[model samples]
Target: MTQLKTLFFAVTTAALAGCAATPRKYDDESSRALNLARAGGVYDQDLRDSPDGTRSYRKGLFTTLLDVASLATSFDAPLRHLSGTQTFMFNATDIMATPDNPSARPSLIGWMPGSLAANQDDAYEHYVTVVDEAITHAAESMSITATKLTDVKTPEIDEHPLMLWSVTSERYDCGKSNCIIAYNIQQPTYWKTPSYVTGREAASYNIAANHPEEYSRLIFRQSGDERTFPVGEFYSAVSADMPPWIVMYFPPNTVFQDGEPLTYPVLYEQGQQLMFKEPNHE
Candidate 1:
């Protein structure tokens, strides 16, 4: 009788743990639509169908306990609302950094149930503040100036070649130009790593051969629409005492504008009207 009670308690605890660690899924239809329209239906199918996709998780008792343990440690994770850290290389362009700006800000906390639940007590204003602060800091780190433009809308912006955007998280939007220069990292707050890192190499999936120790893995991709793309090389910040943020790196002279090889090097141009060029270049 005592053994039965112990077994039941253990089972219940494990179940609860799994539930708590699991991230809530939200309607990703908009994201899917964007991807399908830009990247194609086949690539979207690969992500949805593959076992190593971002959504796939290892099931069973061991995985459950591991997830529970991870959740405990993850409570102290910085930027709890965001899955990972990102760095933007905006070149003094007008940055529309709002969540609605799909090109500038690919993903949002409200889009994820698990992310929202973690900060349920906080007001919506708090989320906006945090996001704004993050974007500002990211720009500063690269010695680039990012002026937040509240009046401008994202779609109105023209495609600029110098804009080379990168992220190290689960999802990314390549914007209208159909160029992708991003990588994937395991979510700092979640037990599971993103699928792009774990999934097998296929069309639109090329794992980084020499990813650093700090990151789980990295993948670089050029979207289905063939355009003049930049050659991005990955590097890690060497610091003994760094913050827990998952930092993404992009070097200058790599991103180009149109077919012309850059006579001047710059990155992270904001909108169509706000563009970046070297002082001498026309």
Candidate 2:
């Protein structure tokens, strides 16, 4: 059921974002794209049957973790040796959306997954632990990290508030010509952590949006870096070849420092919310 919802939102919003691909961008009252960018897995409520260490989750602190495992199972990644640090692993594959457009990227319907033991505490939760480790590994293995980020802030629109952080590190980059992608994954959702944002100002982070950029589509690193379809990497090479309607992840207004970029996690409070109640939201 949850996967179904994700699929609906994914394809629908992707279509909305894709509308801009035509001549003269189309700015409908649609917030579908923004909601789609909320970031999460296709398996969410459907992966309960996944093996010992695999699962799905909504785009949250822990959703990144689920992405690592789910994506690895369905897609291949350039980075290796990340599994050792992960808590679980998926043993399945062959579940991905391989669009037939050179400009599009592969997405997923369902995929295998992996998991790791989680720790429950006030100072930190299992999800935060997962994000921290991915960042650490991305830094060590990818040799990259965002340069400036004290708190979440919009990189594209300075006045948009610090809802997200951006990075310029190699690991975070898409390694493409003009495109780039960056994100960290958290562990699977096992009801072990809070369902929503839980920072000191948790009440401030429930903001949701649908439409994204005029020049770009705000792609969610949903499954984070775990899936075979890397976050900002290629759209699966499968026969379903097409450019991604949604682009990869990045902070709104990223900055470079000493030749590299920095990032901070996003905090979507009510004020940080986007316009999701648009007429085209459905």
Best by lDDT: 2
* lDDT agreement of model 2 with the native: 0.26
Poorly placed runs, candidate 2 (over 4 Å): 1-124, 154-165, 169-282
* Candidate 2 TM-score, C-alpha based: 0.22
For candidate 1, lDDT tens digit of each residue in 1-282? 999999997786555434323332322432322222112111111112112222211223223222211322333233233221211222112122222111112111111123323442332233334334544465345333334443322222212112223332222233332222322222222233222211212221111111111111111222332223322211111111112112221111122335222222111211111112212222
CA lDDT scores, all candidates in order: 0.25, 0.26
TM-score of 1: 0.23
Write candidate 2's Cα lDDT for 35-110 as tens digits: 2333322112211111111121122433322233344334334223334212111111111121222112212110
Q: Against the true structure, candidate 1 has what lDDT?
A: 0.25
Question: Model 1: residues >4 Å from true position, as ranges?
Answer: 1-45, 48-106, 109-122, 153-282
Give the lowest summed-lDDT range of ten residues in model 2: 105-114
State how far residue 192 of model 1 sits from its true place (Å): 15
